[model samples]
Target: WFISYALDEYFYFGIFYGMILVFSFYNLIMFIAIRQKQYLYYVLYNLSVGFFEMSTDGIAYQYLWPNAPEWNQVAYAFALCATSIFALLFTRELLFVKAKAPRLNQLIIGVIVIRLIFFIYCYLFNQTLFSFKFIEAIPLSVAFFTGIYIYKNGYQPARFFVLGYSFLFAGFTLKFLIMLGISWLNFGVVSYYSLSFCFVLEMVFLSFAIGDKVRLLKLKKDKAQQKIIKQMAINAKLKDTVNQELETKVEERTREVYHKSLIIESKNQALEEANSLLQKQAEEISRMNVLLEQDNEELQTSVEKVSRDRVMNTEVDFEEFSKIYPDKESCYGFLAELKWSKGYHCRKCNNDHYFSGHILHSRRCSKCGYEESVTTYTIFHNTRIPINKAFYMIFLIYSSKGKISSHKLSELLSIRQSTCWTFGSRIKKVMDERKKTLKKTGKNGWS
Candidate 1:
């Protein structure tokens, strides 16, 4: 009978302790992977429970402390103290009780300090009091209550935390009853390892709690990224609408310029007919010829001045300026022509062959696959302002002889005062560099 009982005891204790070690090792690896302190504390708590089980079963005395018989009396007490402390620490970190429930967090800290003081007193004065392991019910109950309170306040992860603690709470309650002289409730083998079973259940659920928290945080991050993408799409649509409106204005201006040319051509034809008819009246035709020549000269000079002024003049209204640039497409078209008018050559490989690039009015080298935007080397590179607006701002600053205030420029461009000032200052510096050229080249110097 003694031999048979020893075999059963070894088998059951071996299996239970093996499971505890496995849980401890697995959580230690989790702590390494995530660097979360809660996992480390959980591993410690599991090891404490395993140690307490070993000491109570006399396995620690036989295997761990074989030379020291005196430690067997208080070994379980030390293990219980570690278990309660580590469990409280794990609860504090896992549930974020500090942030959610500051008062409850302080209470948990106080409980830990009191539990330590009692353990020290018991260690120094009377080690026999260490057998009253039911005192653990206090710290365990504190952890359980904190989980419930945090879960009630809408912390989703706390649901699993509370569930995990409920099992441990039940196991502790049963042990507390057994300590209160309820011998009939202890059902042999099942009752002996009930707490071990509860520890495993709690370990599994606490893992679920950590996973649930990570999932919730990922969902929130994804939502914020989606909002940013949607706003970018809306901004692109607004820019396209502005381009379309500018294109419509350009079409209207083209029609007006064509009509004016047709009127000038008809007047020239009328003058030729009059010259032919009055040829016999030489004096009269001579005087008429001089007058006609003067009128034509005045009209031609006026037309040239107006066209050039609108292109590079402060006096030119924004409405007139839109006819020249009109839209981002038109601005990009001008930049593309100016940048690569000579020939297409790869800056990276010096290859001449290329393809149209992903960006509008950009080119990509076929050899090196190096793509270059039209504005890459220009002043407009990396600028967030619309290309057309940047062009208009430049013309305004140049025509105003760098005298325009940032506030006035901001009002006209419908841009921020700081932005206008920054861009305007850069334009002034460029104008200063080309001041001599500007005098010789007139309005075309901007190009």
Candidate 2:
């Protein structure tokens, strides 16, 4: 009988020690990988349980602290205290008790402090009481109750946490009953090692609880990212739709303005000359391409004519016109030539002889010393917009026969609608004043 019991005890220690080492090492590696405080606390909890088990089974006396037999009596009490403290800490982190149930979190902390005080009292005064490990039922019960309270309220992972603790709670209650002299319930080593079996189950279920929490967090992150992508797609589609509608409206407006321009051209000799020259020159360039088609002046002249037409035509977009008048100096050169087409009769003193003034393209009268800028009396005077954009606005308004709206001019010139309306109103007022002269002046009527 003694041989069989010794073999059974040795086998029980081997399996229990293996379970403790496996669970502790696994959780220790998990803690290192993820740096979660819960895994660290769980490792400490498992080690304390292992220490308490070794102390009770005389393994600590045989292998560790064999020379100090006096110290062995209260060592398991310290391990039990550590076990209670670390178990509560692990539960608090895994179940998120502080955020989920503030009152339950406080109770768990209070139980830890009480357990520590009780362990210290037993060590100092009554060392014999350390053998009654059934007293740990209070702290274990408190941890188990916290899991249930947190799970009751919508915390999903707490369901697994509560299930794991339920087994440990049952094992502890069974041990208490057997200790209270229920002799029939004792089933040899199976009943003796019940807590070890419960530890294995608890370890597996807690891991499941951790995995479930991670899955829920990933779902929330993916959903937020999906919402952002969906919103960006909607914004891009709306922008494309608005651009298409604007392009369609601009095409229809250009067709209407082209017919009006043709009517004006038919009544003017210079317009007919320029139009015929363009068609005749375009044909000359196409004929040159019939042989060799090398780069030359005739092709260059055709490109220059098209560019020159874009400068005067209302149908031209601002980007095309900008090639001809790229900056303020180029715009000023055109303004100076047109303002002094007839003569430079200064407004202050109508003297014709002049010298270059301080400002670019400005002319100073020699006799009276009166200086006049290119934009002195022009519609572009004191305008807030760039001179090049103002020049394009005039070209668009004149070519459209003053029929184009300020909104259309704003889009074409890339200027503010209010500024376009103000400048366009000035141009239209001048056109209204010179209506009769424009009728007789032909294509040069604008200058």
Candidate 3:
């Protein structure tokens, strides 16, 4: 019997230490992952409980059981009460109801303190304030209710707690039944196995629950990220549409401006041509006026010669008179001269002379009645200004050198500044036309 009991004690110690190591490792892993104060507290409490169970079992049953050693009983009782107090503290903190039900938690704390004090007093004074049966049963009942409360409240660790406590309660009940000779099995060893198995099961359940919670949290986070990505894609598409619309509007506006520019260019070309024609007419009129002035000077000289010859008592010089008149018929001789110079021969009369006008200063053809004024085909036709004024305007433009102010030109010409500016602009247009024509001719030559 002694050898069997010794073997049982050794086996129980091995199993108990193995369970302690496993729980310690599990607690360390949980602490690393969660880093919660409540989990640390639970780990400390479980370690204390493991220590109390191992020590009490070693002393009470293994060392002094059947002999009832005095010191062993005191040690056993102390370990038991300490383990109960730690368990109570750990449960209260786990529930996190210390704030909501402060008085209840404080009452439990008070009870543990009072129980500790009484246990110490009994150890020192050799008195017992409470029976062992009452002490053990009361704490067990409190543990059972606490486990049920945690489970009902949907605490994640509650399933482990409930399962573990249920196993412990059943083991204790079986031990009591054995003590009363109501069972044939060795309830003490069975209780140790039951408690260890339940602890391992509880740890497994706790690990699964924690893993599930973490996975759910990750899933929710991923869903939120996907939602944000979808919204961003929608925004990007909207931005692309807006940019395309803006580009289309820009292209439309550019086309409109191009059409308007073409219209403006056409109008500008028409105005430029009109100005060039006016400038050419003014230049021709100036040339014709200069020729008329020269002819008048020659006539005055001839008249003076005639007067001198008369004073000298000489007969009228017929040669000089004929030279002066030159057959008034040939006074318009220049009209035929200009037509013949053009190399035009009349087919109806078979001679260029037939196409020429016979009447003095007449532009009408003697043969065919075809007529044209000397200035008709020239640039001087239909001019409004006097020839001298046009010549003066051109001279002022060339003499001003650069960027001549219209106001200065108006003062010099004794004309309105508005009229001077108009004339100046018309002259610039003619100059531009000549430049454009020269450029076109140059390009044609190059081609």
Candidate 4:
């Protein structure tokens, strides 16, 4: 029975130490990779705890330090001191005990100091019982309270810390009970594996707590980010609404300003029209005075032949006439302008109102329905020849220095002698009528 138990103890210690070494190296590499002090402390604590357990099981004597039996005696105490120091620091960092549980943090520091003092005293006296008792009462107690305090305060990972450490404390308690000869709870050979299993479970639970903390933090960050985004969207919507309202107000004000400007512009136009009318009246009065003065001078210079002439030679030559009246439309437009210089007036009905005739460029009196041509009552009236030729004939007759006979005028104008004579007679009659009209008005007919 003793041989089987010893073999089980050895096998279990190897497995337990191997598992702890793996955990320790993993955390050590993690510390190196991430540069977190907590991971480094955790690795040291795991290694020291494993060493203490191995020494208690006599594994250090069997394998590690067979040549140095005295090392076997002192190794457990040294390992205990190292484990307590590193574990205190690791728990402090992991749980942020200094900030969250300052009283408990101070208690842990006191425990570590007491353990260190006890370790030195035990090393000198060659005793280990007081150190073990100190660990059970103070450091473990402080760790438990710190876990509870942090857990109660809503630290998310503290629950795992409590659970993991509870298992470790229970393992220590079980081993202590067995040492006091608690036979039934020891479970014979199985007791050799119990502590190792508890330690493995503790490490697993602590790792789980770390993972849970990361998950919770990430969830909180994501929720906060979502809230910020939602707020931004609301703010953007509010900004857009404000901008739209401002734009509407601006547009309404702009329209009001535009309406006021239009009123001002209309008033300015009315003022301008009144000023133009006054200016034109002033100019007309001045022109009439000038014309009356010029009339006396023209009467002195007038001759019968010059007064009877239909065309003024100085007013326009053939070159100018061709330019001014290039086509039938040009001649018609000029005659229309001259005829209606004072506005359209019907000769037959003596009405100022007229409508356009169906015939090209003719007007009919609105009251009498009498049609009028642009050429009516003018020199080219009742013309048998093209109006352009008639104009040339008149021009040639009036523009000549000496009297132009019908035969010579016909050859020059490319018309028959009879036609030329008739045209000339008609022109002469019109001229006589104009001369009589001018005399009746008591105004000189030429200048």
**Local distance difference test, each candidate:** 0.83, 0.80, 0.57, 0.74
Q: Candidate 1: list runs displaced more than 4 Å.
A: 124-128, 246-447
Off by over 4 Å in 3: 59-157, 173-188, 191-447
Clashing pairs in 2: none
The TM-score between candidate 2 and the true structure equals 0.55
For model 3, how does the per-residue alpha-carbon lDDT over 140-177 read when each residue is reduced to its tens digit? 66756765765686655556566656766776676566
Model 1: how far is 75 from its true place, Å? 3.4
Provide the lDDT at 347 for model 2: 75
Q: Between candidates 2 and 3, which one is better according to lDDT?
A: 2
Tell me each candidate's RMSD, in Å, in order. 12.2, 23.8, 44.6, 42.8
Worst 10 residues of 2 by lDDT: 288-297
Superposed Cα deviation of residue 84, candidate 4 (Å): 2.2
lDDT of 1 by residue, 1-447 (tens): 999988987887788788788888988998997788988998998899888888987889988999888888888899999999999999999889899999999999999999999999999998888977778889999999999999999999999999998998888787778778899989886777778778878888987887898789889878766765676587588667765765676577567656655755665666577786645555554565576567657756755665555444557777667666667777898889988899989989999999999888899999999999999978898888888899989888877778889999999989999999998888888788788676776644443
- Report the number of the highest-lDDT candidate: 1
Query: TM-score for every candidate vs. truth?
Result: 0.57, 0.55, 0.42, 0.54
Per-residue error at 205 for model 2, in Å? 2.0
Q: Determine the backbone clash count of candidate 4.
A: 0
Higher-lDDT candidate among 2 and 4?
A: 2
